[model samples]
Target: MVSPVTVVKCEGPKLVPFFKATCVYFVLWLPSSSPSWFSALIKCLPIFCLWVFLLAHGVNFLVSRCGAKRIFAGLIFSALGDAFLIWQEQGYFEYGLLMFAITHILYSSAFGMKPLDLKAGVVMGLISSFLYTLLYAYLSSPFTYLVGVYTALIAFMGWRAIAGVQLCNDLWTWTKLSACIGSLLFIVSDLTLAVNKFCFPVPYSRAIIMATYYAAQMLIALSAVECRDENEYKKKIKVT
Candidate 1:
């Protein structure tokens, strides 16, 4: 099992230029639905911003560990997924899907197989199975197999993230907590996207998708922060 997390000084994420650029779409400041380079850039700005921030954070502060590097790699793929997905109408859906699958694989690698919690596995499996069952009829040929594989990967990612919690160890650090929550949010965002794309169109689907996706990316990015241990933090508080 991976050791319980220890941090140096946990400073949270700083809002980024790319993240700020994406806000306009969510707020309907630019409501264009057309496919264009500018639109794709805006759609993917959040992930780009997070990647740069993670790199900077890792260099300037804590989280220079293996986990942070894997997370950084995942963000790179995630940004590519966003870019490819914006051109989904022009037939890049599968490529986008592939990129995200790699992203999750890297994320799961970062979380590691700690505590080997069956409870987390079961929960993730049931949810993934339910989603696949719901969309089975709509999936045809290769997409059927592809989506199934993607679901399993995501479930495993979720399982690994949850297992990192180590509730028994009483090591509920910000990194673990944010990573857990971020993984779940990533699942939720993907679930909504899959349902909307294959089953039926969700009203305001783009907004919903981008909102959850950005939030998930943000949290995962912040998970790279390394901070003082709980006792150490408390001790400093007492001193102050």
Candidate 2:
């Protein structure tokens, strides 16, 4: 049988690699980096890898610990959505949006699995509605409609999470909130892209938008790790 000391040492080794991977991914976002197709490709590489890493491990983690299958499914869909959004090929926006919508639906369902207060939903809805409306006013044509729908869906997911409050521990709560905020930043980044594509003649638009986009994806990955950690902790507690 493994002694407690041995278990602790094993845990330490696991954390070192996790932190190292995270740091490596985070450092790629520094400004002043040259813009090349290769650079852009590298920037998105971490998120794609992270998505795969988490989905493969996260499902097992959840199944053995929290038994939250829905959460696992949501994460898988969200990761796929992220992957779609990162694709740079022309005429793929609608397909990306469709995947993102599926992600929102899964996220919302996961959030709803937790018990929550009704008022949280109302508050989130109001805030999301106001923000999206203001944003939509500045966007052109069908892009505005597309973004409006996306915003509403994400807002609803966030509200559901807030209301359900499945993240019982403070750390988990923080992680969930960070992921939600990251998701919002991603939406902003995409909106910026749409503006640039359709209406704006702004300089450095790609840089600005990509900065936010990368940051958002990084934060979401961090949150996923945190959520997994929290679930693992709870499992240990239950076992003890």
Candidate 3:
């Protein structure tokens, strides 16, 4: 039998701070004020807390070592990206796009391309192509190229995240599924944001975008954690 210490390591309690911070942001911060650096920091507090939890947690296990570092970096970038977008200061849009593009690249790399799932890739490509085509006329010169690259990066990230589901067999299945769903939600959130910003105004667009974005980040972060089987986890906690 696995030792109690090992069990505790593998079956540690989840990060509660993330959820608490998320609730506080949506309830107290999202609609309170105009765009500012402070608002952005408030918006990204949950993600920042998640990053801290990953670093400080007792668990030594990880779904993937390479993935862990990449996702952590991605979280940092994501927070920076949020700050730019939320502030919406002069030239901040481009900076936001740049940060988010890097975030997607890191996420895609961490998700890995082990199975070579062409089907998922093709689907992501088709969707991104369609969206870009739709947004083409509205995009100005610099934004045209910037948005295009960002779209491609996000699509690649989504493809990798969805394709990773195939790697799941036992304990990792939930995490795989979590990532898959998270990626899809990220796409939805971005799609809504793009439409509202470039194409036309979307009613309640801010709420929709932030809602999906937060959930996507949360789930993706959770998926990176090392998961244990139910009975095994129970025993581990019992021992602890």
Winning model by TM-score: 3
The sequence of per-residue lDDT tens digits that candidate 2 reaches over residues 39-61 is 44454454555455455444666
Clashes of 1: 2
TM-score of each: 0.85, 0.58, 0.86
* lDDT winner, 1 or 3: 3
Per-candidate Cα RMSD to the true structure, in Å, reads 4.5, 6.8, 4.2
Inter-residue clash pairs, candidate 1: 7-227, 10-227
Score candidate 2 by lDDT. 0.57
The full ranking of all candidates by TM-score, starting with the best, is: 3, 1, 2
Off by over 4 Å in 2: 1-44, 55-59, 62-89, 137-141, 164-184, 187-208, 211-215, 218-240
lDDT of 1 by residue, 107-156 (tens): 99888787788987998899889989988999998899999999999989
| Alpha carbon lDDT at 122, candidate 3 | 98
Expressed as tens digits, the lDDT of each residue in 149-200 for candidate 3 is 8899999999998887764443336667777889899999999999988899
| Pairwise TM-score winner, candidates 1 and 3 | 3
What overall lDDT goes with each candidate model? 0.78, 0.57, 0.79
